[model samples]
Target: MAPKLDIETYPGNIINNEFVPTPNTRHSINPATGSPLFKVPVTRAEDLDAAVEAARKAFKSWSTTPFSERAKLLLEYTDAIEANRDELENLLTKEQGKPLSLSHTEMDFALSWLRAFATMKIEDEVLQEDEEKIIYSTHPPIGVCAGIVPWNWPILLGVGKLGPALITGNTFIMKPSPFTPYCDLKLGELAKGIFPPGVVQVLSGDDNLGPWITEHPGIDKVAFTGSIATGKLVAASCAKTLKRCVLELGGNDAAIVCGDVDIDKCLPKITTLSFLNSGQICMLTKRIYIHESIYDEFRNKMVEFTKNNIKTGAGTEEGVVVGPVQNKMQFDKVKDIYAQIEKQNWKTALAGQAEESRNGYFITPAIIDNPPEDSQVVAEEPFGPIVPLLKWTDEDDVIDRANALRTGLGASVWSKDLKRAERMARRLEAGSVWVNSHFDVDPRVPFGGHKESGIGMEWGIEGLKHYTNSRSLWVWKKIFE
Candidate 1:
């Protein structure tokens, strides 16, 4: 049975282990229905200040607690979330417009991150050790850390930042996207009983709130997941306080389908990922490069698969593969691309209607066949259920075209020939390169971006260090004697 989307119990911002409401409030819109799901507190300057101060006060104790102890509390918090998993999933689907199954997947993804963080610890590194002298380095928490989460995968990405920030001994404050703040605030509500006061806080606000959190003097670091333009603004705002930033920005990821690949085996994976979350994912395969030898056959098959297998509707509907675009801003952006498609008279293997007809923000997936490399549909990250399939003949030429984009978040090469795929994967400019796979991220592995895709890393040991400051210590043996 599906859970109810009642948010009456989880109200307003979470500060110092209590729900703090503001006079000014805003309602979260459901992309599936274009209706107000529930009212969310519009965090004011005072609320931001209080949340920051609370985190600062909690930091004194949280930073000193043993890693094992902190991990224990986080584990309990995970349990609390598990107990209410159904509610979180339902709320997420209503707000973010992903299918209910995907919502469950996001919850599982978030819990896995918390569990992984619980098992990992940051220990002092012995740089040099001898009878004469000993030298080592320690990772100390960087005070209060802020996580600015996006709407696409609110819980999973929020936990991606929260787990590292708290497990490493830093008190955390989360700012969920205004478009999808319900589940995040509810998560914070669940945390009230598990984490100590001020150890974990969540504030939901409008556009103004992001600048406040980024520019806040009390926040020592910020981990942001959003568009490249917004990420730039975040980094610039944090520059004033010289706060550490871990940005996972946009990706014009390219998926190269080789002639040798079993088209039937790989078609489902490509189409699913290309339009997953309505293509709102930062690491989604925005550009597809198919070998000319099999391009025609592959394109037709992909179009047929999309026509036969994919269905768009509200997430609650059974057997719906794609949901509405998460919000109006994105829906409008994709609509603009539709205009571009008409203006240029480009060929579309599968075309969705551009006109707004449905009561919701639903968009059928579109696939442009053999569009020019410089066209908007191919060049820019549409971030919708739209993609371009281009033809590639020469290996070197194809690799260069795939790497031409300024953003390099993720890329993949598909081919049965292991040596050939491996060789091509090495040349693609991306933080995560895969062969016969896309978006296969693991908690044990470090995930981040290269070039303008992002700065710094998240997950794994490297990501944990981003929330900490490194300190070196040297002790002479003679001094102790």
Candidate 2:
């Protein structure tokens, strides 16, 4: 069971370094308990205007501040988050419906990312230099960026936008999803004293908030992480202003298991990768393709593991390995896919029922064995605990099937044979490919999807450059002389 929370007292929008009340407020429900968790201000268009103006004002000084000085402030922010790590983690678990342990890991990643960004410096580049002319390029900050974060990993994704935007000298205003807004809003409140008046701000609201932020003339860039449908809307809105945008959208990641691999050693890992965070992560393995020779054995092992080890309940429950779906919307989405599975009469290797007797939105993890290629469980990203296991006879055939989807965010190949794994990994179409592992990301490596998965990159030097624009400088010597 989870501790009862007082959701009424959570902070509202942060503008000009202070928590301000808005014209209206909305309540966010706890996915694990199916109850109201907190009430956040529903930021209207006017509130967005105010937040944008505040960011614009702060950018004047923040953009000009030395990179070293900005780094110091970010480090300070990292320290503050670390100091309050436990409290933040608990809050995240309560609202986000991730296990407390996973919430701690999210905080850990957020801290490491902030620290990494703090130490990085993008120096001016000299494109050409000669006795007669010197040409150099400067990466200047794009002012007043709006970071739209999703609910799955709100704090980490929010910081993913913030680290790059702030380290590169742009002011940021974050719009957290209404599903999970408590921790992010609190983070903004904590950052008030660390950053300048408007360097970092957070606003929470209903669906309207995202459009207002993306379309606002005052915003120079929009960094968004969400579904493909919503990402398209955000892009269209930014297109009107010709504002820069970085979108990390949806992914139906695939994991291929080779016949040559050891099933005993690999089955445990594969199950963990598939169902981690209740399958909410964008990069998690949604589709599993196994070689025909080992498909039956692999399927049996996976079913046994999931049946024995995978348990779903409230996030705060001590022995629960998986928590409830993040919210009712996602829960219903998963249920719809289950309905499709039932309609198709797909072979179910393992399935469990939700604890409707309890108040939380709990659904048992499900594993479907070899659904049709065009089935919704196989073709679409379920983004839930439901996954399909397909058998493939040929490597080339599986590669083609894996890449056939509209989304190409991430994929993995598992085999004990190093050379074989690498060769297959190269052929799969994705931004990130792993051998024998999945969802292992580092702050230093660049992460983004190919095709419809996302546009632009995040978390590396390439990510930092996205928050800035390039300006060329040229000096001609003695042309007249």
Candidate 3:
């Protein structure tokens, strides 16, 4: 059963494991209905200071807490989330404008991630032993951490930061994007009794909140996920405090489809991947390079599939595979690209008109037919349902074209020939390369971006290291003998 949307019952920020309300508040609008979903505390500089100080005060003991105890708490928190999964997922769909099905998927992914971290342990490493001098290394939490989560996948991304930060013994303060703050704020509320005071906190506000947290000297690290433009600003702010940052930014990911592949088998997966979350995912395929031999066939099949299978509507509506675009800003951006396509008279294989009856930010998916390589739609990260399918005859040329962009977050090569796909995957300049698949990420593996896409990594053991600093311990033989 879906949970009720109750804005009046909204709880404020979670600071020191207590609900902290503010004099000022802001409303989060439901993208699907263009109506206010709920009101959240409008956190300001002073509020951020209080949250940071609380986290700082709590860090002394939290960081030193036994790993086993911390793990038990995290596991308990995971259980709590699971028990309320339906309620959270419903709220996520209402606030974030994703299909209810996808919202459930996001919840499942987050639960799995939390469980993974609950079972993980970071033990000291013995670098050298059985010698005159013994050397070992210890990974310790890096004080207070600020997790700036994006709206696209709020719950899952929030967990991406929370799991590592908490498991590694760091007191964390999360700042959810103003566009979607419900689930994250609720998460903080749910964790109140499970985690110690100020151990896990959440603050919600407008644009000002991010700068307050990032620029604050009390924060030891900033883990951000957003656009490349904002990511640069985050890195700059963190630099002022000499704080560590893990950024997962934008991607203009490409998928190279080979001629020998079975078009029937691959078309379903390709279309789904390309338009997953209405093509808002950072790693979703934005550029398609198909061998000229199969370009026409692939394009036709993909167009037909999209026209018949993909439907956009309110997230609560049944049989709706694609939900409305998250907000107005992104909706305008997508419309701007459509205007460019119309001006250029670019050929479109399939164009689903925006649904006007819904009175929301709804734009049908579009497939541009072989636009120029240098066109804005192809070069820039549209981060919308619109995507370009280009023709490529040569492998070397396609590889070069795929790598020409400033971003290298993810890419995929599709072909029945495993050896050939492997060879091509090796040369694709991306943090993750897949053969005949795209955007399938696991919590156990390291995930991040390359070049301007991001800095540092998240998830896996490497991600845990990002939340900590290594300390070297050495023992020297005494010469008293």
Candidate 4:
């Protein structure tokens, strides 16, 4: 049985291990039903100040706490989250519009990440050691760290930033996206019992909260995951304070299918990569290039698979593989793109009318067949269920086209020939390139974007170092002697 939601009892801004609710509140709605799920308490400017001050004050002790002790606390927190996993998944499905199974998957990912960060280590590196001199490098935690999490994968991304920040000894304040705030706010409430006052906090608010966090003097660093346009603003805001920043921004990932690929074995994997989370993931395969030799067959079979296998409905419904768009703004953007595709009369293997969907912001998944390179479907990231399938005759030309985009977060080359796939994957200008797989990211691997996609890395030793400042120690033994 699923738990019931009660709006009045829902949580508010978490500051110093307390629920600090203001009179002003925003309705957190269910994307599938377009109904209010909860009245999320909005954090005011003063609340922001309090949260920052709390983090700053807590930093003094947290930064000095033993790394092993911090790790223990993180593990304890993960256990607490696991205890409430079912309720969290239900809330996530209601608020984020992903299927219940995907919500569970997100929670699983979040838990694994927290555990991974807990066990990870950053040790001092000895640059040189000799009779005359010894030199070494160290990483020390920055002060107050703020994480700006997007709506798409709030819990996982929040943990991605929060885990590293806390384990490295920095106090943290998370700003959850206004569109989907319930589960994250609930996590904040859960933390009160586990962490010390001010050690972990979450502030829920409207658009103004982002500016407050980025521009605040007390925040020593900002780790943001969102769109390219907003990422630029975050970078600019942090520039004034010279605050350390780790940004994971937008992606226009491309997946190339070689002629020799195993069609029967790979179709489901490709479909999941292209349409999972309603295609809202930053690293999802937004553009697909199939070798011309198998283009027609692949396109027809993919369309048939999508039409027959995939189901779209409310996330809570059984067997729902795709759900409504999370909010109105994104739904509008997707509908506008579909309108353009219709106006251009682009050949589509499967095109559904988004406007015709019942009450909620559901856009039927559409697959355009061999759209022109400059076409909207191919060039822009619809960030919806819409996917573009284009034919590729020349490997070099296709690779060039894939690299032409300003965003390069992830890409993949699929072929039975491992050497051939690796060769093509190497040429794609993405931060993470894969052969025969897409979106197979591990917490131990470094993941980030190149060029306009993002500014820094996340999810590995490199990402852990992003939370700390580097220091060098040098000693002259001869002088001491």
**TM-score, per-candidate, Cα-based:** 0.98, 0.97, 0.97, 0.97
Estimate candidate 2's RMSD in Å: 2.9
RMSD of each: 1.9, 2.9, 2.0, 2.0
C-alpha lDDT of all candidate models, in order = 0.90, 0.88, 0.89, 0.89
Q: Candidate 1's residue-wise lDDT over 1-481, tens digit each?
A: 2223355554679999998989988887888887877788999999999998999999999999988899998898888788788878888898899999999999999999999999989899999999899999999999999999999999999999999999999999999998888888888887777888999999999999999999999899999999999999999999999999999999999999999989999999999898888788888888899999999999999999999888878899997878998888889999999888889999989988755545688888999999999999888999888999999999999999999989999999999999999999999899999999999987778999999999999999999999899999888888756
Q: After TM-score superposition, what is the CA distance of residue 258 in candidate 3 from its true location, in Å?
A: 0.7
**Candidate 4: tens digits of C-alpha lDDT, residues 183-232:** 88878877877888999999988999999889998899999999999999
Q: Model 1 compared with the native: what TM-score?
A: 0.98
The reply for model 1, stretches above 4 Å from the true place, is 1-6
Candidate ranking under TM-score, highest first, comes to: 1, 4, 3, 2
- Residue-level lDDT for 38 in candidate 4: 71
Return the lDDT, model 2, position 249.
Answer: 90
Model 1 has an lDDT value of 0.90
Count of residue pairs whose backbone atoms collide, per candidate = 0, 0, 0, 0
Model 4: which residue pairs collide?
A: none
Tens digits of per-residue lDDT for model 2 on 206-324?
A: 98888888889999999999999999999999999999999999999999999999898988888987888988989999999999999999999999999888877788988677888
Error of 2 at 124 (Å): 1.7
